[model samples]
Target: MTQATAPCCDANPDPRTLRGCCIGLSVATCLLFSGATTAADSFWSTIQLHGFAAQSVIKTSDNRFFGDSPDTSFDSTEIGVNASVRLDPKVLVAGQVLARRAGDMYDGTPSLDYALTDIALIASPERILGIRLGRVKNPLGLYNETRDVPFTRPGIFLPQVIYYDKVRNIVLSSDGAAVYGSLYNDLGEFSVTLVGGWPVLDDNVQWTYLGGDFPGTLRPNGSVWTGSLWYATVTEQLRFGLSGALASLRYAPHQNDILGPGQTDIVYGIASLQYSARRFTLSAEYGLEPVRWRRYGPLLPRQKVTSEGYYLQGTYRIRSNLELMACYEEGVADSDDRDGSEFAGVTGGLVPAHAMFSKIATVGLRWDPTPNLMLRAQYQWNQGTLVLSQLENPDFPRQREYWTLLALQVAFRF
Candidate 1:
């Protein structure tokens, strides 16, 4: 997944960095293979290596998304390599590196997506418990943990209302620790995960929260706390999940800065459900976000608001290797100002009311010609620009209230 909250550097990546990452991945792969062949029964045999690469072409009838879409763009691509080694029966080490390019949001920087040590506390047929240390993916909604892997995604793009790409860095991954446990029984299975860590903060976070980059610096005020609980039926036909997060940040002022030191707190929660039959799957998720800002001098007063988002999606397997999908999603930046009238009024009409919310309807097709390859095409009708990021579309005033997008992608995994 893209960094959910952190705003890093320029969107255009350095050529040196891209080359280094590719060379590093090649070296790592060779070393792993060499060790495996050197000692089949040794530690090498416990190693697992996997990777995936995907490229997408996107076009839009109006409003820019994932590049200059009106002119047709190929700015969306993802590549990742991961490896795991079992050091002992109860211990394992795993890591992954990812390079992603998403229009002006990301610059194909090769970054360590995750590097963790997993220690099993308990292992049995009925129950299991474990702890992960190091940078780990924040287990948010159903798709967040695995969003970076195209093969694992149900569609070319996730429901942006919930798995938003604009502020993805804010909740993408964390550095710290996590505890997970699972219980299995005839009736159903229960599972839970708790995470305490600091999110990767960057300029993008500033863009998402503060609107733009300030002269001063912004950093995590403290650890972010996230948790999730899930339950599934015996046959796994029905599943439910509840997840939430508490995140905070602080900003320091520079001399002569327009703003003073301030703090921002976000409280978010979501409920997810999915039901699967032999050929079709139905899924839905709803999320609420309450945000608070305080002590930002006279220009920015203490304020709070709750935003809401939800989506309903379904997919039908047309054949052994093909599927059809459709989804509808909506998001409101402020439930109290769902139409943005109040917000726009407060801004003295500088911002349009339509900017406060977004709605999207989509239809898509997925085909698997080979076990490791996937082809997808999707069409989206959208209303509102609430989901578009300022970094990608700097000319906010020129944004359209309604737009349509078409996307096609090819992916391969091993």
Candidate 2:
């Protein structure tokens, strides 16, 4: 007997409506702060504002990324503003608003990135406990929380294998609460965070998983939970982290749609390590994501697939203003079917085997022209199309197994 496919969203709200809502929220927040007294002794003195803007140019030998990169596209831009205020010694509130455009993946829409209130339950020098309520950034791999900030990243682009942009929204942040704690001792310094909440689902997520803009819509149907543990030595030169999450979603089909309702469960874990010296830094991360699907319709089968990926990266500061970096990243859709031949065969060769995995070697240079300005240039040699966004490369048959990409970006922060 055949089963129905997963249920997904049939339609979404207008982009302008979403943008307007975010803008209104930001305006209200600003108004709230404006009502505070300007006196030096007032709580306004403890407020801080920060933001950044970046633009990138990308070119590709084959396949499109971030735009029509067949030639060169300047279709990538990121801008964000954030604020934080300390209500007291133990209470703080922080939030950020962002607008981004990246070809077909994102269309320069304003959104609420993160807004949370943090309370220190136990405050001490060596040990502290805290809880955060609101939309919080997910504590996953090393670079996930700060992925949008160019200054905090080693290169223009992070390793795509583990931090794939295709499914970024699913892991970026969540609307939930978290409890965190830290302990310091002679043995080591350790920190732990546990969070449970609902994930943000968007059209991009649906496109990434369903292969295109399906008639049905996909949304988070159940709760998602994540936890991370980190350790660092007394010297703070070496650090390690372990993170994991369980995410579930349901797809509801539109009336008259050919697809049936379905559900997906994803469990993933990541291990990360980093070593830093005065002018050199080395880091690596490995991740395993196992996905299970049920009642996915006749075209798709009910199956369990485990994806694995890893990356090794190093950065060296040649001078106070110049830095060089290199990295090797690899990802496989299924460890048991590394080549994807079986998948292609099962799908009647409609999907290429290269779609199952990706390997990338990259090198880049970063120049800090000033304290708040940065310029970067990078080159990548990629094998396979596993990590590329389907929205950008709609025609899979036109994609090449081997391709090269060059990117240049300018960023400013204040």
TM-scores for all candidates? 0.91, 0.91
> Highest lDDT: which candidate?
1
Count clashing residue pairs in model 2.
Answer: 19
Query: How many steric overlaps are in each model, in order?
Result: 12, 19
Alpha-carbon shift of residue 108 in model 2 (angstroms): 1.1
lDDT of 1 by residue, 1-414 (tens): 010112334432233233333433444455446545645575767889999999999999977788889899899999999998865667667888899998877878778787777778999989999998777788888889888899888899999889888787668877778999999999799999999877776666677787666677777899898899999998899999999999998989989988789999998899999999999999999999998988878866788878899999999999979999999999998898888888778777667777788999999999999999999999999998788876676555677899999999999999
> Model 2, 160: alpha-carbon shift in Å?
0.7
TM-score of 1: 0.91
Candidate 2 has an lDDT of 0.81
> What C-alpha lDDT do the candidate models reach, one value each?
0.82, 0.81
Candidate 1 ranges beyond 4 A from true positions: 1-42
